[model samples]
Each structure stands twice: as structure tokens, then as C-alpha cells.
Target: MTAVRNVHERVIDAPAAAVGALLDRLSAADDPIFPTPAWPRMRLDRPLAVGADGGHGRIRYHVTAYEPGSRVRFDTPPGGGLDGYHELTVAPLGAERCRVRHVLECEVRGAGILQWGLVIRHLHDTMIEEIFDNIERAAAGGVARPVRWSPWVRLLHRLTWARPRAVGTPAEARLIRSSVDRPDYVDAYRVDLLPGLPRDPAAWTGVLRDAFPVLARDDGELLMDVNTAGLTARASILVDDRHVTLSTAVKTDSPRARAYWGVVKLVHPVMARTMLRRAHRALALAAPSAGERAQAQSPAPERS
Candidate 1:
């Protein structure tokens, strides 16, 4: 077994109380840190107190200890080759300065070591630095030089980004469903509409691009005319509270259109899924960070 201990620390030009207040909101709906969108947001089944259960992404851990405005710790369940705890701590450096630190200690054997050294380590380091960046931005006003993702980190992010899954055309997509009677081709792809992503169907029209004219819009769906290549077609982008779906319907008017669609149908699913997934990720990355959103929504100070 190999033991691993990794640490990251940053000094913020803000009072310990201020920085720690941000720490206390770790898994909050409006968390002021944790560097989300670019990465998975930390989540807890309940509030961020001792016994809270949840972790970001695939990691599974539960809160082991909590100290309101000073520190918090989480421990993974036992038995895995990688077993241990990770925690965040804040200490006052002076009247207007504080040090924020994160530490991960674990015991790894066999494949765990390779996974840690080759992949997890790089991702962890990048994520930690980004967290510190958000700390400085939120608590101390701004980061002089925000951390930049390395090529390896960027590659990993792309490879791990969530992809859309195939789904039947939603009945709610009335525009597309009724646009093509006896359609020659139809398909749909869906992905979660994660928090912080846009809900406006207009914003999602990029899935079919501007070339497609807006045919109609319902309460939550945008229908666009995608007629081209001698085929009559329509595309629908549906945005609801829980999911976003992209659906397409095509009608072949003649033998040429049918033959052309036969060849296009082979790659249509892949293309539709790819476009939807790309749009999902693009919107996520463009959204304001959780910290920024929290700060924006914070109440303004009273003028005495």
C-alpha cells in the first residue's frame, strides 16, 4: 500500500471570518466557492453540518466534522484501496488576512496508485487551485492571476464531460411532432438541464444554429424550420426544469429526397447528440460561477 498526502494553500487578503464564512457554505445551493460549472458542484444530501452526505461528481463521502467558520472534514467509506479523508481549514494570518488550505490523505494500493498519479492528481491539483482562485475572487475582491487549466486538464475535462442520451421525441414538442406527418426520419437526444444553465429556449436555438428559421415557440420549446437538401424538416429544442431535449423530424417529398435522407440518416443521430451535448457544455461554461451568482444575489448594504 502507498500512502499519499497532497496539500494546497493560499493566503487571502480578507479576514478569517469572511473567508471562513465562504467555507461554511461549501455544499450550499449558492456556494461561494468550489469552482463549479467548470467542475462538478459539491453537493450534500442536507445542509453542510456534521453528518451531511454527498460529494461532487463520482466521489462519495460524508461530512465527519464541522466547525462553523473555521474548518470542515469529510471521510470516504472504508474498504476501497483509496481510503481516507479530505478537509478544508481556515486560519487567521492577521487582522485582515487569512490562510485557506485543503488537504487530502489516503492509502492506495495497486491500480489506485496509478490512477492517482496519472489522472486524479492532476485534476485534483487543478480543482484545488481553482477553488483558491474563487476564494480570492469572492473574499478578497479578485484574483491577480486566476489559475489556467493545463492541456492535460483541459483534455481530461473534455473526455469526462457528460454526453446526451437518446430519447424518444417528447410529446410536449408539439411543433415538431405535428410538423411532419408520416416522417421519414425522427430522433431526439436529452441531457440534464443543470442549475446555472440557461432555461430560455431562445438561448438553446444554437442546437440547430441561426440558419434554421424560427418556426414557432411554445411555453418551453423552440421549433425551427431546417428544410434543406430537398427535404422538409423541423427541429425542436425543449427546455424544462429537469432536462433539455433536442428532437428532429424530416419528411422526404420525393425519391431524391428519400435517397439523400437514407445516407444522412446514418450520421443524424450522432450529429444530433453531439450538437446537443456541445450546446449543454457551452452554456454551462458560459454561466456565471456559483460564487459570482451568490455575490450578485446578496443583499445590498444600507446607507446609514
Candidate 2:
């Protein structure tokens, strides 16, 4: 059967060896990009080696080929309706420059098409660009440049998935307002609760703690750390069966830090909304049953 393929390529200022080394390190458990708050977290079961098993989140794969400081590929199984391979390669340009390329080739059918068509394709493109930007930045002594979505992309996202709310501070239980004058980025999404699910704040919090590692959920405050941008920001996370809101405040004292964060902030809406949406799904799955809710709300039995 013929396979589908996707390729991403970018030139970096660093030497081939440096780029290769960084990519090698990234191929292992600790990826500089995989921890992106906007995307799902990835964990490798072990270090990169031919025939080793791992992939992002639930996408399992085994390494098919490996070459130190050059290229590597992983092959996923066929049963998931996606039997394909992804590869990373680096090539030198003189002593101080190189090209980095990532390729995906696989046959996807059934459920895989839905997953890829709906979510993974867009996120993968955006992230691959950011990874290119990151490698360039790292090679150039850590100068910062972040990926920004085009208006068309943002518009499509809004039209397809997220709804627009008026720009202002929201009333409690209302949608999040990300409006800010100086540093611009805003995104919010709201969806109705699924049938048979009731808003249970306690159960929602439990699901969040287990599924997401980005937001530090606490009684009165929330915090997020996007180390790549050197941002330590405060966010508000509130949940109920009826509505869920994720909000954050942005301010910086240092001029350099402000400038850096300003660039990264453009993608915050996509990042923020994506994360909260996942939380919403997890909360739905973990929603307590009717019987359990009734038990909790019921009054204690009176003494005989």
C-alpha cells in the first residue's frame, strides 16, 4: 500500500555536529519541544536504540534505525490504523551551519485518519516550526524567537473549534478573557457537558492532577512555567460541570525578559486553550456517577 509522508526542514546556524548532538539528546526521554504546554507530553520508555519502544503519550513505537550524530527513525505498529515511520536527519554546511529535517511516512486508515486529520497535523506543523526556531536560537547563544500563527490559521482555529467571546474581563463562570494591551494574545473555548456527566469540582481537580503536569493547581492560585521562554506566569484555573475557565496574568520587570515573553505570548492562546480542552475531556471521563454524587450530597443518618 502507498504511504503518506510529511517533511519539515530548516537551516540552523549551528554546526552539523552541534545540531546533531542536540537532536540526539532530544530523541531520548527529555525533549526540548515535547514538553510544550500547548501540546501533549511525550515520554520515551528508554533511550534511543534500534528496537527500543516509545512514542508521544499513547502513540507507541519502536526504533527502526539509528546513526549517531546523523539520523534515526521509529516505526509504529499497524493495528492502530497507522503503520508508518518518522525520521530526523542533520547535514553539515561548512563548519558553522547545517540543515535539519524531519520526515513522517506511514499508511494511516480508519481511526488514525480522524486523529491525524483533526488535531495532529496542525499541531505538528506549528511545533516543527518552533523546533526549527529553537534550534537556531540555541545555536546562536540563546537569542529568542517563537512561532506565531498567521491570521488565517487563527481564524480557521476559531471558526472550526473555538468560539469568540467579547473582549473584556469576564464575569465569574464566564469565558476566560486574555485581553491585554501591551502584549497581545487571547484564546478561549467552551463546550457543553456531555450527557450523563455532572460538574463535580473535586473530581475535576483529581483528573487534572493526574492528566496534566502543566498547571500547578491549588486552592486559590495557579502557576505555569514555560522554561524555554523564561516565563513564570500566574494563571487561574476554575472548573464546574457548567463551565471551566483558565486565565492568567502577564507582567515582567526586566526589559529583556519582557521582550522575550512578548514573542512567545502570541502562541499562548493556542497553548492555553489546547491544555484546558484536554482538561475538560479528562474531567468528563472522570465525572462521578449519579449514585456517587448522591452519596456525597446526602446528609448523615440521624441517631436512633
Question: lDDT (CA) for every model shown?
Answer: 0.85, 0.55
RMSD in Å for all candidates: 2.9, 21.0
lDDT tens digits by residue: candidate 2, 1-304? 4367899997777688876765676544334423232333344567767877766545677888889788888888878666888788889989877988989888877776876776667766775776676565445434255568766545444444423132233344221223222433333344344433434433434323334334444442233432334444444445444444555555554677679877777876666656665565554435532222222344223322
TM-score, model 1 to reference? 0.87
For model 1, the run of ten residues with the poorest summed lDDT: 295-304
Candidate 2 at residue 205, lDDT?
40
Query: What's the CA RMSD of model 1 in angstroms?
Result: 2.9
After the best TM-score superposition of candidate 1, give how far the Cα of residue 22 lies from its true spot, in angstroms: 1.8
User: What would the per-residue lDDT of candidate 1 be over residues 1-304, giving only the tens digit for each residue?
Assistant: 8999999999988889988899988877678788777787787999999999988887889999999999999998777667999999999999888999999999988899998888889899999988888887777767788888899988888778888988999988888898898997888899887667788999988776557789889889998888878999989999887789999999999899989999999988888888887788888888877656665666323322
Which residue pairs come into collision in candidate 1?
Answer: none
Per model, how many backbone clashes are there? 0, 1
